[model samples]
Target: MSSPTPPPPREVLPWSRFGEAARELARTVADSGWMPDLVIAVARGGLVPAGAVAYALDVKAMGTMNVEFYTGVDQTLGEPLVLPPLLDTSALAGARVLVVDDVADSGRTLELVMQRLRAGERPPAQARSAVLYTKPRSVIEPDYTWHRTERWISFPWSALPPVTATATDGA
Candidate 1:
């Protein structure tokens, strides 16, 4: 009988490394002399890193743009969709903002967010992007990226399966 094929290899980012990476990324922005007034997280992946970067940079103003793109590993929707609990565009008006995400796998999600951020009559004074990882096939390069890899990554936060409710009745 023929054996089943092995799964593809993936890069793993442990929690320990993630903290250092996020700090280093924040330092990159600081060294660039580009001080953003606000930091925008692209939820749900960007939430963690954005908070880290914002804290590191001492940027008090923070917000989130909820976008759902990836359905599962190597799976994506036809296009990215902006979910509800949307961020107010007014916050972008004349403000220097930093957009943060976990990875730029396809770059489509980032593009969509950028387009929307710049759409309204009063767009931010400046907008930049930062990410923990960048894939080889990504179309848009982030302003700050800690690592570049072609392999799928197992981020510490997402490596585990979602938590399900426990049965109240004992088996």
Candidate 2:
């Protein structure tokens, strides 16, 4: 008989844990000696973490980039797609920008963001990217990373349990 293959291991990152990671990331960015003029978060996943970082650094201006890479159940075969109404490039001109994201999975999102920023008419004087968590084997590495793990992390919503109403019997 042929041996059966084992299922992939599951990794969970609770909301509290994620928050702690974000705080640590904020601390690292503060200690990096680079004061960003604006904070640009790669939207959706990056929004929460970026907000925390912005608060920690006391930065007022915040921007977001909405990019979609996944659509359905199958996680394979996807490319980064930038949503329209992008942040104004003029605001970033001659300013330091801190790009924030939640995790760097394949690094495609970060790579594309950098590319777009570089192509802008008025790019930032200096641009740095940060992430709460990063896969150690990621091709593109963030300037600042809070934690590194090998397991693939599934967001809470993705694994949420189904809701069901329970009936109570009274005596």
Candidate 3:
């Protein structure tokens, strides 16, 4: 029997591509007519897109939640964990809040973050999530998503182009 061919390397979604996606997402959120009291960015990947969205919406107050899932090469070995510096729910109480993230992979991160945000001493009744990309299999869907793809997205850093590598290496 012949063996099946292995899949090709994942395509790189560069910063410029992410920027375009973020812009589209920002426009969608802005046109929704739902003004958020604050923008809560899921740390690390979410920071850039959230900042762009906040700027587009003219939102001032920004907060972050740091959650770590993978620690280097062992992506599947660790239990998904939320890091310290819990969000100050007091600021979100009874207000509309927008939770922003780069990609909704398995939906676990967003779901857990939303749970934490809602489980606070004072929870916001109205909370929505926005993501730049959503995988087809994502369990929890964001209220707003800029793009959807069935294939896993390889970010810029993961698949550095020759030009990017040369620039970084000063070659």
* Model 1 alpha-carbon drift over 4 Å, by segment: 168-171
Give RMSD (Å) of candidate 3 vs. truth. Answer: 4.3
**Scored by CA lDDT, what does every candidate get?**
0.93, 0.81, 0.80
lDDT of 1 by residue, 1-171 (tens): 999988789999999899999999999999998999999999999999999999999999999999999999899999999999989888689999999999999999998888898887789999999999999899899999989999998999899999776786443
Candidate 1: Cα lDDT at 104: 96
Rank the candidate models, highest TM-score first.
1, 2, 3
Best by TM-score: 1
C-alpha TM-scores of all predictions: 0.95, 0.83, 0.81
Of 1 and 2, the candidate ahead on lDDT is 1
Number of clashing residue pairs in every model? 0, 0, 0
- Global CA lDDT of candidate 1, please? 0.93
